[model samples]
Target chain A: MLGYIIRRVVAAILVVIISSMFVFAIFFLGPTNAAAVICNQNGRCTQERQALLEHSLGLDQNVVPAYGEFAKGVFVGRTISTGPGAHYDCSAPCLGISYVTKEEVTELLKDKYPATLSVALVGGVVYLFLGCTLGILAAKWRGTTTDKLLVGSSLIVSSIPYYLVALLAWLFLVNEFNLFPKTGYFPITDDPVKWASGLLLPWLVLGVANSPQYARFGRGSMVETMSEDFIRTASAKGLPRNKVLFKHGLRAAIVPIITIFGLDLAALLAGTVFTEKIFDIDGIGKWGLEAIPVDLPVIAATVLVGAVLVVAANLIVDILYSFLDPRVRLA
Target chain B: MTEVLHAREPQPEALPTSDSDPFLVVENLTVQFPTHDGLVQAVSDLTYCVGLGQTLGIVGESGSGKSVSSMAVLGLHDEKRTRMTGSIRIAGKEVVGASDQAMRRIRGKEAAMIFQDPLTALHPFYTIGAQIVEAYRLHNHVNKKTAKQRAVEMLDLVGIPQPDRRVDDYPHQFSGGCGNAR
Candidate 1:
């Protein structure tokens, strides 16, 4: 088991490295010139200024050498020359300075990441619990009015566009009804109450929007699980009705649901662009969106971060699968 | 004179037979499904009886309602999808149209079924020991340790080696031939 985990971890690191390289390559090959972007940020983009910008940003060098510098920056610390002799010391695992803000990309990401994580974590828990509960209820009450109502409602909700639902939530729940306070992000350390209130709307919007999909998945898998022979065996064991549905049936149904949940949660953590944008939260998602075109370094960092998050989530899911399903042998 | 005599005479109620009967009896059981195509008859007018200490082997070809009939005996079929007629009695207790609560009381404790495929019959997420323990704990008033002991005893009874150690193992850890039975 230890060997298997080690092998998996190694493979996950390799995937992150390869994906980061791809993101780096794409940034260099793209139409937008990093040097021009930097020069443009200075309120002027003359040819002389562009050339100077290219030299300072080290973009004038070949792509290979530039990539080498980036790679070195990740392993050891690198000094970033703002202009002439002015330099800033960027610590290890540096992602370079943003061309627009001249701030360390890593530092910026660190500042903004907590908000995104808060939204995703809270929203993920709500949706998973709500979806699975509704699904289990539907499955246990199959063919009854309650089952039909839940399934129908889930189908209807899933059929609608997610962005629209989020938009509607903001419009009615926050703006019109004044059900929740103004949507924004506040650091929890500063004021816990403000932090909770500020993020409540986004959590609801994101959780409710994502729940229908989970509900549908849960219902389908649950229906299938109910028909499994083990379910019958469990029923035949004279287990209570609740135990048959929850213990035996729902346990099997949760595997596929968790797989979907891992990927969804990872994506949300990396960036919830719509949720953050609609709610005006200064999260990593909003930051990444704003950085595009003007800041290649931040965009590249976001890509690498996204890849790492996805890989990590998948690894967690695989480990969880082994625990949930004894039939699956990791080795 | 006849009317006066009838008024004085008392009647003996002819109640259904009690106590002296087979352990399980299925009489004129018919199961049918109405699909979009048509009404498909799975089992037609099937009748069978099993006494205590009797083993009945239901032999039939594929699609001949062998599994269907047995599943009906356990009340495993989906009530919404299939139409069932007639009666299934277990030790003189009516199985057909029994409430879910009643079925739960009688199912594993009074009558149980050994499924055809062990691989599919056993829950993959649970260890064989945990599954067996759960089954035993459901019908019996036993704690975790006692339930586990019962599980081990059951495993040993099924010819599994090292029942104490094997109780910790999962279904995948067992060989293919160890068909799951309870």
Candidate 2:
């Protein structure tokens, strides 16, 4: 088991490295000029000024060496010179200075990440519990009217675009009706009450919007599990209907749900662009979205972060699978 | 050679004696399922009886209502989907059209079923010990530790070696025969 985990961790690291290299290669070697972007932002880009910016940003070097420098910067601290006499001491794991913001990319990510984490974690829990409960209830009722109603409602909810739902929720609940408190992110440490209340609306919207799929997934898995021979054995053993459904049935049913959940939560943590934007929360998603076509460094950093999260999530799901299903051996 | 020949020869069917009393009786039992296409008669007019300490072996091709009939005896069929008629009495208790609560009391206590495929019949997530303990504790008034001990004894009784340690192993860890014993 320890060997299996070590192998998985190594594979995850390799995936992250390859993805980061891909992101760097795209931004550095692509048609878009990193130095030119900064130069154009400052003023009219003369040839000399562009050359000077390129040299300072290390863009003048070959792609291989430039990538090497960037990778090295992520480990040891590197001095980023935007121009002559304008050097910024970017600490270790530096993602470089944002061309537009002039702030360290790592600092910007650190500041915005908590808001995303707060939204994702709270919303994730709400959706998982609500979705799985509804699903299990639907499966228990199986062919009844209640089951039909739950399945039909989930289909209807999932049919609509997610962004539209979030937008309408924000527009009415916060803007028009005064139903919910004003939606924004506040640091939990500063004020826990404000944090909860401020994030309540977004959490609800995210939970409600995403839960329909989870409900369907859970329902389908449970239905299949209920038909397994073990379930029949459980029933024959005189276990109550509730025990048959929950204990014997749900344990096996939840494996697939967890797999889906791990990826979804990782994606959410990477940054909920629509949720953050619609709710006016300053998260990594909004920052990355704003960085497009303007701030190259911030975009690269967000991509790298997203790749790391997805790889980590996949590894976690695989490990979790071994626990949930004994038949699945990691080796 | 003469004795072997006599054994190979077909003998006349033996009739039930007056002293034998049947414990389970199924009379004119018909089970149907309504589907999108039409009604499916899974089992029709099935009549059978089994006396105490007697074994009745049911053999038929797949989808021939063999499993369906046995499941009906235990009231394991989905009440909502299945249409059952006639009478099924297990130890003099009527099973056909019986309420779920009545069936619950009878199941595992009065009668229990062993599924055909032992590999799939055992719950995969739980250890053999846990599954056995669960079944034992359901009808028997005993603590988990006692029930577990009983489970170990039962496993040992079934010719399973290392019953104490093997009880903790999951169904997939056991061989096909071991799983059936479990």
Candidate 3:
């Protein structure tokens, strides 16, 4: 177990290394230039100011020194100087400096984490429960009218794009009927009521749209699990029907579910740009898209955050594997 | 006058014990399936009973419906696809056609089950003792320490070595092929 933990920790470090390279590479390979963006934003760059920015920001320095500074900030803490507005500690283990904002990418991400987590987790729970319950009921019926309707509805939901559904929901539900407030976001602490209300509609939109796939996934798994001998055994033991379903069948069926959830979390965090835009949420997805052309720091931070979430999800799945099904070994 | 006086006696219940009634009984239970291919009889009019503290085994290879017939008693088998008709009296209470809430109440306290494979039966991440304690505590309102102590006792009873120390060890720590019975 110690060895496994060590190995996992090393692997995590390697992942961060690779992710950092990707972040650097994206900026390097892309058509957009951070310096040009800065120049454009500045209207015109005076020579002294340009030289100061270039030398200080390491445009004048070689890529090695620049990357060395970045790595040092990322891995080992080191203080570095930046603009006059906010005195960034610029300690070691920093992701990078924001080209546009001239702020530490890590700080920017840490500040906004709650928003992303709130949106993802609450929405995830809503969709997961609704989807699984509906799916099980549909599968129980299998060929009846309720089953047909559920399958057809899920199919329709699956066919429609997430953004389009989100848009329709927002416009009609929030704008037309005025049942919900217009697309807006508030921090949970800043205003709990508004925050909950805001996410409620998004959750509905996201849940209704995403739930079909989950329903199908869950139903298929349930159907497959019901055929397993253990389920039969559980039932035969004169265990209640609920026990047969929840105890044996549910656990057996969840392996695939967790795998899907891990992948889904990553995809949602990345693809949630549309949802964020529609809902007017100032989350990383929306901000990342907007900051792409102007600021590399925000983009880098976004990528890092997304990668962290994906890693966390994987860890959670691994831990859950040993829980959901006893056959799995951590080693 | 004699014909008018004569009365028909009721049929005797299957496996009626001398001292007390049997805990569970199944008689003339039929479980069928209607498919595109044909109507398949999964379990056909099978009868069996298990009294309190009695172990009953239904041994058969795959598709023999040994398991299916038993599932019918619990009403665990699907009602729509597979047709089940007959009596399944559990602890003198009818299991078949029983309400969901009522069946849920009978599951763990009145009866709990372990599967053929112990590896699958135990949840991997949790310690065996923890799982057992949880199972015990779920049905009873005992405190954590009391539950833990009971769990430890159960571990010792199940032949787990060093019950106190091993109580915290996860299921993976156990050697393979124990095949624990619940």
lDDT by residue (A200-308, candidate 2, tens digit) is 9999989888888888889999999999999999999888898899999999999999999999999999999999999999999999998876567898899999999
Off by over 4 Å in 3: A42-56, A75-89, A266-271, B1-33, B40-79, B82-182
User: Per-residue alpha-carbon lDDT of model 3 for B1-182, expressed as tens digits?
Assistant: 23212211212232244456488888777677789998888887788889888999888999999867765555565555765666677777666656555555555667555555666555544566666675676668899899999887877888877888878876556776543723
Q: How does the DockQ of candidate 3 come out?
A: 0.17
The TM-score obtained by model 3 is: 0.72
Clash list (residue pairs), candidate 2: none
Candidate with the greatest DockQ versus the true structure: 1
Q: Report the poorest 10 consecutive residues by lDDT, candidate 2 chain A.
A: A290-299
The predictions' CA RMSDs to the true structure, in order, are: 5.8, 8.1, 7.0
- DockQ, prediction 2: 0.63
Q: TM-score of candidate 2 restricted to chain B?
A: 0.86
* Tens-digit per-residue lDDT, B1-182, candidate 2: 35323322332222243454378888888888889998899999999999888899989999999989999999999976877777777777777766677788778888889887787999999999999999889899999999999999999999999999999999889988778885
Q: lDDT of each model, Cα atoms only?
A: 0.83, 0.88, 0.70
Give the TM-score comparing model 1 with the true structure, all chains together.
0.91
True contacts kept of each: 0.95, 0.86, 0.19
- Tell me the TM-score of each prediction against the true structure: 0.91, 0.92, 0.72
The true-versus-predicted C-alpha distance at residue A32 of model 2, in Å, is 3.5
Candidate number achieving the greatest TM-score relative to the actual structure: 2
